[model samples]
Target: MESCLPILLHSLCFVSLVLQISYASDSISAGQNITDGQTIVSAGGNFQLGFFSPGNSKNRYVGIWYKISAGTVVWIANQENPLNDSSGVLKLTPQGVLTLLNHTDGIVWFSNVSRSTQNPLAQLLDSVNFVVREANDNDLDDAIWQSFDHPCNSLLAGMKFGIDRAKGLDRYLTSWKSVDDPSPGDFTYKLDSSGYPQLILRNGSVVQFRSGPWNGLRFSGFPQLKPNPVYSFGFVFNQNEIYYYFNILNSSVRQMLVLNDNGISQRLTWVDRTHDWRLYASGPTDECDTYALCGGNGNCNMASSPKCVCLTGFVPKYPSDWESMDWLNGCVRRMELNCQGGDKFLKFTNVKLPDTRLSWFNKSMNLQECKQTCLRNCSCTAYSNLDISGRGSGCLLWFGELMDIRQFDENGQDIYVRMAASEVGKILAFSRQSHSEDLELPLFDIITIVNATNNFSDNNKLGEGGFGAVYKGVLENGQEIAVKRLSENSRQGPVEFKNEVVYIAKLQHRNLVKILGCCIEQDEKMLIYEFLPNRSLDCLIFNQEEGVSLDWPKRFTIINGVASGLLYLHRDSRLRIIHRDLKAENILLDMEMNAKISDFGLARSFGGNESEGSTKRVVGTFGYMSPEYAINGLYSVKSDVFSFGVLVLEIVSGKRNRGFTHPDNRLSLLGHAWTLSRDQKFMELVDPSIASTLNPLEVLRSIHVALLCVQNDPHDRPEMLSVVMMLNGESTLPHPKQPGFFSEDSVSEASSSSGGKHQKIRPTR
Candidate 1:
C-alpha cells in the first residue's frame, strides 16, 4: 500500500510540471512564436503586439497597442489584410524586420528594410512608437525604419505629419473605408508645400478643405486655435522635412488626431479625471469651411449676411445661379485687361489671400517692384511680397484666378487684387499724396528660427494675439525668449512696428518690457523678447472662474506690482514714457503674478519737458486707449494716466474696462465703477470671483486712487509716483474730481468702428 501511494504522488507531480511547461511555450520571441491568444510585451511593458479583432469585428488583425492602456492601438501590421481565424503568428526575423503569417504560413504582412548588421532588434519606444534597428545602435538617424514614420490615420504625440522630401515619402492621414472596415477611405490629409506650407484635405485629386498657410501665428483657417492645457502644436520646414506635429503638454496625458470612418478628423485627448477621452477641437465648423465655398475670385465670411462675395473686379459667372445660392460656378472678371493700358491693383484688407500653388516667387523684390513685374507679364493677375519682412522683400506673382479667399476679423493675410488701369492711377495718386508709409521689420531665416523655438511647435506658443501670435523659445545653452510674429494684414502694424522696437529699445526699466533681438529674413519679421511663463495678468485676474485662486494677499501684491511698473515707465525710465495702450492684456504676469508692463507697441516716449504726443492715426485699441486719444486724437501723459485709472478700477472690480456694464446708465466699466465708488457701493464693484479673498480697506483705497487718476481735468490727474506711493499706503491720496467722460445723466450714444454699433458704449474707431 505504501509503494502504491508513492507512485500516485510522483504521477501527480509529473503532470503539474508538464502543464507549466506547456503554458510557457505560448510566450513570444524573435525566432520563437506567438499564436491567436498570445502577445509579445515590450521591455518596459509599454507596448504589446498581438492578434486582435477591432470593435466587435471578427476579422482578426495583427496590431500593436499600448500595454498600459490596452485600448490605445498605435500600429497595425495588417491594415489591408486580415486572417479568417485566430491562427495567426507574429515574428521578428534575425535581420530585424517584423513579419506576420497566417495559419498556413502565408505571409500576411512583413516590414521589409535593409539591415546593416547580422543581428538586429525591434524596439518599442516609451512614446509608444515602434522601431527596428541594428542591435547596438539606438540612434533614430541610423535606424532602418520605424512604424511612426509610416503611420495610418492616427497621429499620436511625437509623430511627424509632413513630407520627407529627401526620401520622397509624404506622410499623411487617410480615413478608414467604413466603421467596420480598416481599408483606406476617400479623404486624405497632407502637408502641401507649393507656396507656403498649409494643411490640405483631399478627396481623390480634388482639395476639400485647407487649414490655410502658417501666417506667423495660427493657421489662417483655424481661428479657434487658442491657449489650452493639454497639448501644443508646431510646424517644421527646413531642408530635411516640412512637417506639422503636436506634443502632449503633460507626460501622463495621451492624445491622438484620428480620421474616423465618417470622414471627419477629430483630436481626442484622454482625461484622467473622468477616465475617458475628451474632444479637444473639430474642424470645418460651417458650410463656408467646405474648401473654397465661394470658388475662385471669391471671399467667404460667416458673419456676413451673405457669406460669399466676389472679388472687387469679378462678377458672378452665372448671375441667376449665384443669386439662388449655387456658387460652384464661381466668378469671372467684369472687364477685359490690357497690360499696356497701365493695369491697376486693388487693395483688399483683412482677408486670407488666394492659394499660391501655381505662383512665381522672387525673394529680392519689394511690393513696388512686384507690382511692376506683374505688369510686365500680361498673364500676371496679382503680385505681392513673397516674404513680408524688412520693408517687404521678395515678390510672388500669381497668373491664374485666385482661389479660396476668406475674411478674418482678427488676423488675416493681405492680397492685392488686379483692376483696370484707370483705377490704379486714381488710387495710387490718392495714396502718394496722403504719405502713409509701410513699416519694415527684419526677417529671420527659416533655420535660425528653427533653432530659436525648437521649430515653433505647440510647446512654444505663449498665447494667441489679436494681430498675430506669440511664442516662447530658448537659444543654445540657455537664453529664454518670447517671439511675436505679426500678421501681414494687421491694421495696427506700422505704429506697433515703430512703438515696439524704436521706442522700447531706446527705453530701459525693470518694470517695463524688454526687447532681446529682432529677426528679418525674406518675409518673416519677428521680435525676440525675454520669455515670461506666467502669461498676461488678464488670464488670471479677470477670469471670474480663475480669479478666485488669487487671494487678498496676491491681489494686493499684484496691485502694488502694477503700480511700480507704471511708475517706472511714467517717471523713472530713461524716457518719461506714456503707455498709451495700458490695459489688462498689456500687463504680463511672472510666476508669482508679479506685474511687468509689456506690448509697448502703442507706447509714447516723451523727451524732456514734452509730456505727450498726439496723432491723427488714433492707433491704440478701443478699451485701453484714453478717451481723449480714442475720440479726439489728443494724447498726453495725462491721457495715459486716465487709461491707468481705468485699469486700476478693473483690477479692483475684476471686470474689463472696455466692456463693463450696468442696468441703470448702460455706461461702460469706467462709468459704472465711478458711480459705485461715489455712492459708497464700491464693494459691489469687486469681482464676485475674488469677493471672499479681498480686504475691504485695500479695495476701497485702490478704488479711490483710481478715481483720482481718471479726473476730467488733466491738471488734476496724479503722476504715477503719487499713484504708486498711494498704493504702498506711504502717502495720503487727494480727493477725487469728476471723472473724464463719466456722466451718468446724459448717456453717450454707443458707436463702434467698422460699422459696428452698440448702445451707450463709445468705442475707439
Candidate 2:
C-alpha cells in the first residue's frame, strides 16, 4: 500500500482518504460517509449536523445545532440509540434513505421512507431542516423524508407540531431521559385530537398539563402567547391536517420550543451577547396550571388565597375534604336538574374552558344557536363559541361534568353552564342586561357572599366611600375577598358599576388591582376584589405612626408605581382611559408595599383617533382636578396626569392636598410645592418621617416632575409618557410654570379655572 501511494498518488484510494479526513460542510452524495471526525454545515452556515456527546456522556449521537452557539443541540437523530464509540459513520444511500452505521457496517439507525429514488443526496438547509431528496429536485413536497418529520425534543421554527390525519403521520416533541443521555424520556408534548385539538403534556399515560382549546387568538390557558417581535404563530385544523407552527420574523434571531427532561415545555431564544439560550417562556407555571387542579365544577384563581371554589350553583361534594384543601373530590350541584324544561344556562366569563376531550364542536353554528342546541339536549352540560374571532361563530358543547376549569382576570373565553331554573333567577339581573355580555368577569352568588361576610357585619367592614361600604370576607375554601356593597342612598348606581366592570375586566397590569367577581342578587349590587393586606395609601400616609413605616425607598417606589399605573391607563391599556378620580385614596398597596391603582368607576374610554371627550357635568375630587376638566368640562389623558402630580406632591410631603394650610400663607400643597420648586428649595418639602433615608436628588426630581404635571394649562402639562420618563430619570426635566388651584379663592364663585358645581357624579353627557 505504501509503494502504491507513492507511485500512484492520484488513485481512487487516495481520493477516498481525502474525503474521509477533510471536512465537507455541505451535501453528502450516495456512497459517501460522514465519519466521527467529519461534519456538514448548512449552506448558510447557521446550522451544523455532526456527531456529539451531550454533557458527561461517553456515548456519541448524531444531532444538529446552531453553528453560532456550539454544543447547543436542537435536534438529535439517534437520541434513543447512541453509538458505543467514534467509529460511527452516517451514510446516504442511492435509495434516498439516510443510515447511521457502526464500525461493523451494521446499521444503528435509518430514516424510514415509503419510497426511494436514484441519485439521492442529503443536504442541510439554512432553516435547520436536514432533508434527503433526489439531487436534481429541490422541492420539499417531492422529497422522500426530512429530519423535521421525526423531531426529538426540539420543535424548531417553521416546523409543524400536530398530525397529518390523511397520512396518519404525527409529529411531536419528547423529553430526554437525562441531560447526559439523549434517549426518549417519560414526557411527551403533543397535540391531542379527540374532539377539538389542544396541546397536552403527558408523562407516559398520565396527563400533566393541557393548553386549553384554541380560540382564534390563542390557547385559552396560555396568556404568554401574545404578539412579540421575534416570531408569528398559528394553529391550523383542516380536513387533511391539524397542527401549530411558528415562523421567525427576524432572520437574525434563533429560537426553539423544547420539552425538557423535567417534562416542562419551554420556549428558548438564542442570545448573541450571552452566547446561550434564554428562557422566553414555559408552561405549567403555577398551581392553577395543574390539570383539573380544582376538579370538575370548580374554579381556580391565582390571585385568590386558597385558589379554588365551586361554581355558582355547586357546592363541595365532601365538606371535610374541601376544608382540608383536598379539592380533588370536586363539587356537586346544590339542586337537582329538572331536565331541559326546568333548567337554565348560567354564563361563566373569563375562564379557561373545561377539558375538550369529552366535548363536541360544529363549525357552522352561531352562539345563539349553540345555546339553544345545548338547551334541547339534556345531556349537554355546557357550550361556548368555538372560535372567538371577528364577531365570533361556531359552537363547542361539553357533555357530563366540567373539568379543568380556571378563572383569569382578563382575556378568557365564556362558557354557559346548565343549572336549575331556581338557581338561574338569582343572577337574572346581570344575565338579562345587554351590557352583561361584555363584562368578562365571574359572578358570585349571594348565599356564599353573605356567609363569607357574616351578613355584612360592621366588624368586618374595611372602609366606606361615596361608592359603598367595603367588607372583608373569607370564603369556605379559605380564599380572602373584599366586597363592596352599594348603599341604597348612594347616587352612584348602574352606570358606575358598568364602567368599572367593562374597563377593569379587560385591563391587566401588575400595577392595577384585580377584581375577582361581582354579586347582583337578594336586592344587592356588589363588586368583589382581591384582598390587599397593606390597604390604601391614605390609610398609611394620613396616620403619623403608619407614615413612618413608609421609608424613603418605599415611598419612592409607590410614587413611581402610581405613575406607571396611570401611564398604562392613559396610553398602554387596551383602550385609552381617562381616570377622572385618580387620587391618593384610590391607590392601594399590596403585601409587598407595591402600589396598584384602583376604582375605575369614573374612568372614561375613548376609541381610536378620539383623544378627548367633553361633558356638560363635571365631577371629581376638588384638589386633584385639572383646570380644563374642572372648568371647561373637557377631559383628556392630561387630566389624569394632573391628578398624578397631586398624588406625587402629597406622597412626598405626607400632606393631603385638600384642607392643607401653610403656617405663613393660604397656599395649598400645590402652591407650597411650586414655591419650593421656584426657590430651588424642593428638599424642604420632603416628609420628615423619611428625612433620614432620602436621596436628595431623587426627592428633588420628584418635586420637579410633580410641578410640571400640575401646570395650569393642559397643554403645558406633560403626557403620562413624559411624566414616566421624568420620574424614571430617563429624560431631562422641563421647568414647570404656575400650577392650578393654588390660591384661596372660593370654588363656589367661579373666577378663572374652578367652575360651577356638578349636581351628580359621572352623569353621561
Cα RMSD of all models vs. native, in order, equals 17.3, 7.3
Score each candidate by Cα lDDT. Answer: 0.67, 0.80
lDDT of 2 at 228: 89
Against the hidden reference, what TM-scores do the models get?
0.60, 0.88
* Residue-pair clashes per candidate: 13, 0
Off by over 4 Å in 1: 1-29, 32-34, 40-47, 66-69, 114-116, 193-197, 215-218, 223-233, 238-240, 248-250, 363-369, 385-394, 424-765
Off by over 4 Å in 2: 1-22, 424-447, 466-468, 493-524, 551-577, 678-681, 691-705, 721-729, 744-765
Q: What is the lDDT of residue 665 in candidate 2?
A: 84
Q: In lDDT terms, how accurate is model 1?
A: 0.67
lDDT, residue 314, model 1: 69
Count backbone overlaps in model 1. 13
Write one digit per residue (lDDT tens) for candidate 2, span 576-646: 78888888778888878999888887789876787788887677777778877788788988889889999
